[model samples]
Target: MNKLIDGFLRFKKNVFPQKRALFRDLAGAQSPTALFITCADSRVVPDLITQSQPGDLFICRTVGNQIPPHGSAPEGGVASSIEYAVHALGVQHVIVCGHSDCGAMNAVLHPERLKDLPSTNAWLKNAAAARSVVLENYVGLVDDVLLHLLAEENIVAQIENLKTHPAVAARLARGELQLHGWFYHIHSGDITTYDAQAGRFAPLDHGSATATPPRRIYHFSAGDAA
Candidate 1:
């Protein structure tokens, strides 16, 4: 843990001092613009990827970036965070981001491997739909290709799950919020966004803006599955 303590020391002595005024202003209150939901993977840093400053993105990191669909549970942690971000913090956008080499998705794709971690197995049930969707649609894919597709499909599935939240639905109804699905390529630091218009994901050349998308999350119909 010395490494972590040293890192904090640097943050306090260097980074924090550099942004002291920003931190001082933010100490009183924060009005972040978006709720950034991503995986617990250490490789994917939201602030680093987006170049966002403190008080910009209220982050929720989960294993596999799993978000239970609304009404599935009475009071899920993800649900509470969503409500707080949308209704209380007034975050204008919600992003469900998945990354390559996701251990959570890897385990989901091979449930047999999670035999020892009962809790992790249970938590990932929130993403079981993505697994089913992939098995039915991506019949022959394997290895890295399978994992990559799983990560992408998981992002799409979680975004749909995010929409099931009542607060999210209400905000969208009033045209106050937008939801986005993102696939972050870890090795290259490239991000691809869901092209709601094309019914697929497209490479975000630089970045994307927060606006009401013309379309929403894509779910594979029975026929669409392999």
Candidate 2:
């Protein structure tokens, strides 16, 4: 708590003053370009990672960076946040980022080991799909390797889940929005993007962009409306 208070004091005295005009402009209105979804992990700072300024990326965080399928519940904070970012804020891109050394994924891989933390056990239920996907697809890797694969697969899985939201689906269909899956390696300080064509996560080199291509716009048909 003391560390956080001191950090804020330093921010007010130095960082805030240095970016006062940018903060002032953002105070009135914000038009962020991307919706960045990731884990609720203290190590993963979206703004710092992406080098984004204030009002650049609207963020949504969950225990495992999970996005429950649309209509799974009538009302959810994650769903509402996604809808607002897409339909209201008109964010152009949605990024689902998962990181290495994810505690949520680690717990899912070894549930019995953490039987003491009932609340943690319950929260990690959200990552059940991620666990199943990894178990089915990655058969023989040892614990560490399996955990890494699960972390990467979770990012891809959640991006697909993100598209299940009505607003996100509608916008994507109209070529008005794009979705991305990314994995951040904490140890290496490297970012990798899921290549739909290659069906793998590859390093995010400047020459190898993995962003989805814009789709052709189409008029909303009866079946097309979400």
Candidate 3:
């Protein structure tokens, strides 16, 4: 952990001093504008990717970026965070981001490989609909292409799952909130966002705003939702 301590030391001596005023203002209260839900992958740094500063985004990181459906359990960590970010923090936007070369997605695509990882396998059940979408429809494709498709589909799946939450649903119905699906191409640092009108994920070009539909309505079979 020397590397982390050294990084913190550098931040304390250099970065924190420069942003002292910003931190002071944030010390009292925070009014973040967005709730960023992403994978617990070290490579996908949300703040760095969005160029957001402290107090700008409320973040929730989960394995595979999976969000359990509302009421699936009485109490859940992800659910609580989602409720607070939407109902309490009043975040206007909710972004579910997935990335290429995701280990969690890999395990979702191949449950056989997760036999030894019972907890991980159980956690990824939230991503089952995405896996079903790819396996049932994108038959015959394999390797990187299949992996890429699954990642995108997983983002879409999770966004749908987001709608089931009461806080998110209420805001959406009143036109007070927006949901976005993002795919981060790690190697190129290129980001693609879901475009409801075009029915595909297109490059999230700089200086452009893409507001995803509350639900893009992917055709996941009934069994998949289980």
Candidate 4:
């Protein structure tokens, strides 16, 4: 905790003064560009990765980055945030990012581990589609590779769930929003975005945009990826 306190002090004394004007402007309100949703992994810092300022992105972090499909839960906290970001903040984009070796994905692949974590077990059912998708398509795969694919697929599944929200559906219908699926490779510090046309997670490039409400689901095999 001392480290965090010291960092705050440094920010107040040095960094705060440097960006005082920007802070003053943001004091009353904030208009972020994107709604970035990712796992609650301490290592994945959205600001650090995207080089964003304080008001650049509105972030939502969940255990598995799970987003329950609309109507599955009534006015859930996650859905409330999605509504706020879309209706109130008018964010242009929503990115569902999942990382390598995700604990939630691990539990999904290994159900026995969840015997003691009943609440988590139920919560992860929101992402149950991911496990099924992998099982149906990627036969004979197991261990780390299977888990890796599960993480990637979970991001895709959650993004689909995100679209089910009334706010997101309305905005998408009006062409006012874009949704993204991202896989962040923790060990390598690399980000691969799902390309709806290509139907695979490839290195994200500034030249291209993530598919908006993809008609087809993106899938990958261990050998098929370059």
lDDT of each: 0.86, 0.86, 0.90, 0.87
Instruction: Indicate the worst ten consecutive residues by lDDT in candidate 3.
Output: 208-217
Off by over 4 Å in 1: 206-226
- Candidate order by lDDT, highest to lowest? 3, 4, 1, 2
Please list the residue runs of candidate 2 whose C-alpha ends up more than 4 Å from where it truly belongs after superposition: 207-212, 219-226
Query: RMSD per prediction, one decimal?
Result: 7.7, 3.3, 7.4, 9.0
What ordering of candidates by TM-score runs from best to worst? 3, 4, 2, 1
Q: Which sections of candidate 4 miss by over 4 Å?
A: 213-226
Clashes of 3: 0
| lDDT (tens digit, per residue) of candidate 1 on 1-226 | 9999999999999899889899999998999999999999999999999999999999998999998888785337888899999999999889889999999999998999999999899899987788888888888776788888888888888888887789998878777788888899988988988866566778876556322474345557999987
Q: What is the C-alpha lDDT profile of model 3 across 108-201, one tens digit per residue? A: 8888999999988889999889999999998888778889999999998888899999999888877789888899999999999987567689
lDDT of 2 by residue, 140-195 (tens): 88999999988887887777778788998888888889788889988888999988
Residue 82 displacement in candidate 2 (angstroms): 0.5
lDDT of 3: 0.90
User: How many steric overlaps are in each model, in order?
Assistant: 2, 0, 0, 0
Error of 1 at 169 (Å): 0.2
